[model samples]
Each structure stands twice: as structure tokens, then as C-alpha cells.
Target: MGIDDRAPGRPRSREADAAILDAALELLIERGAVATSIEQVARRAGVTRATVYRRFPDKAQLLIATIEAAYGDPPPTQEIRDVEHLLTGWASILASPRLRRLLRRLYGAIEDFPEIARAYQRMLGQQRDQARRNVFERARDRGQFPPDTDSDVLLDLLTGAGWQHLAIQPDNCTVEDTERFLRAVLHQAGYRPDGYRQQLVPQGQQPARPGDKE
Candidate 1:
């Protein structure tokens, strides 16, 4: 779809385009940038060299597009209405091992490969950092964090916990344990899910899950 207008007989093939991107991403994760070549990608994708050339002028453009597609733009930041919503948002990340692996691979390799590193940060890293900042700021405004709380520092601490889980604690901790550890961190930061969610419900309506209990 990103290619220039095609000649009369050959309309661009979306399937080939996707196959090339998928193969490129797999190679990027498996072998790193140096080993990911246009010929190899085209072979793995089951496409001719011309198909790849039509979509991307060179290996650099192809690989950059692959990295961008892999690390998608972050979701739009939402208002953090309460501690419970924020906790649930984070709990989902802790629950995903695949996400943990992808993150660890990126985190582990960035320093040695400067071009891919810069491209990744430009594509997804800044957006993710801003999303964290937004959560912390909204939480602070709602009294989940103290007025003096440094959202940036808090973000680092939270991200640090994730990094620890990815690199150091992957074998040592279960997902439940990770959630408990994060909850403890939030508790220290003045976030109490029971306190926030219960207040949001009407007097007669009970909290849907047992997690509402302190």
C-alpha cells in the first residue's frame, strides 16, 4: 500500500507486503540487524526482489519500516479516573509473558545497535514514556499520589520493577507475585484500590470482584 502506483498488469500485492514485513521482524528478533538482508527477507517472504524494491528502496528503509511496525505507536493516553483503573491497566502488562520477552529483547540489545535503537525510541519509546507520565499526573491530581510526588521518578520506579522482572526476576517470580509487588509499590505511593473503587460505586452497589477488599 505504501508503494508507488503500479503498472497496468501488476496491482500491488498486500499479501507480499505483509509477508516481507513479518519475515523482516522475525529476522530482526532472531538474528539482529547485521544478519537481516534484503535477499534473505525476500526469500523468506516468498517474494521477488522487485516486490521488495517496489515497497522499500533499500535494506535500511525496509528494516526501519519493520521495526516501526513491530513497535507500534502507543495508545492515546486516557484520564486515570481512579487507582483501580490504573492498577488493572498495569496488571495486564504484568500478566503477559510474550510482552515481557519482546521488551527484554529490545532493552537488552539497544545499546550495541545504535541505528535500530534510535529508530525504536523515535517510534515507540517516547510515546510509552509519555503514557506513563500521563497516568502518574492524573493519579496525582485525583489524590492517589501525594501532591509532592514526582511522576517522573515514580514512572522510573515502576519501569524499573518491570525491567527487573524481565532481566533478573523472570525465573524467580510468578505473575501473581509480580502483581503483589507492584501493588505494594502503589501502596507506598498512596494508591489504595479499595479506597478509590468503593467510593466510585453507589451505596447499594457492591464491588464486582473480591479484589475490592483491602
Candidate 2:
């Protein structure tokens, strides 16, 4: 939307909405939470402060919405048919430059906007956790993991691998290396990748190791 767009409380235009969210996200990543404000967003968006506040009601809500807009929704886990699907999808997200920086911005802004950061992280984390849980359940039912597998424990290991690469060790490992590490870690965590035989382990027992082929 150009300057002199429709006033707030009027029939809002998608153009204006897009512009406002885009500008807010840019400022959030560039200057971080404390530096980003409705006034600044309005100025950068070429919309009025009333437009922003009327759209968002508060700074926290505005910033959160901006983040959601940038990243969109987490991929659904129910669609994942196997461990390969799960790991590859996660690899894509973990290796994303956009997501890497977004996590950085969220933590960086946490000190300034504790409530907002917490709220956003909770929203994002819940969706991610749910997705992971679905994949784990699927893999378990298909015998991709041992029958006795603790899904949540396995998830923690996988999640930590992604978190370490994205937030803590972005420089220490390249994207390809990070993805490879995740696959390796998933194997160690008892995920038998697709195409491997699903040798269903008995309940309350560890998975079987590979046996030599005849």
C-alpha cells in the first residue's frame, strides 16, 4: 500500500495488512524487539499508527503476528509416513537460514519483551512438538522405532540436535553437515531410517542391531 492509504477501522486492505506485517518483521529481525514499535512499523509501512494499533491492538500482538506471517505454519506431522519423511522435513527446517535468524531474533528479543517472546515461543513450540509427536507415534506403530521406545525422550534428542545446530552452533556446522549429523543422531536414537528392515522389537526391550546378510 502506498502513502495515504485508507484510515484505520475502515475496510482494511490486504495490501496494507501485508505491508504492515512485512515492515514489522523486517524491523524485528534488523533492530530486534525493543527497537521495534508500532510507531516505527507504521512509519516503515507507510501506514498510520492508528492503522497498526487498530490491526494489532498492542505491540506484543503485532510483533507475534509479524513472526507468524514470516514463518507461516509448521508442517503437519500426520502426513509423515516414515522416519525418512520426519527427518528430511526437520532437516529442511533446521538448515533454513530464515529460521536460524528467526530463532536468534526471538531469543535476542526475549530480554526486552519477555511476555511477547514467551508467548510466541510457546505458540511456535506447541505446534512443533505436536508435529514431532505425530511422527514419533507413526514411526512407533510401523516398527520404525522399538516397541519400547520412549517417544518424548527420542523427541528431546532430535529437538536438541536441531536446536544446537540452529541456535548454538550455526557456525560450527554447515547446513549439509548439520543435516547429516541429525540423521546420524536419529539413527543413534533408535530411528531405523526408511528402506531398513522394520525388525519389530519386543515391548520393554531395546531394538535389535543389524545382522550380517547371508
Highest TM-score: which candidate?
2
Each model's lDDT comes to 0.67, 0.73
Regions of candidate 2 where Cα sits further than 4 Å from its true position:
1-4, 7-10, 73-82, 121-124, 167-176, 195-207, 211-214
lDDT of 2: 0.73
In candidate 2, the residue pairs with backbone N, CA or C atoms under 3 Å apart (3 or more residues apart, or in different chains) clash, namely: none
RMSD of 2: 4.0
lDDT of 2 by residue, 110-140 (tens): 6867988677657565666776787787787
| The candidate that achieves the highest lDDT relative to the unseen native structure | 2
TM-score of 2: 0.77
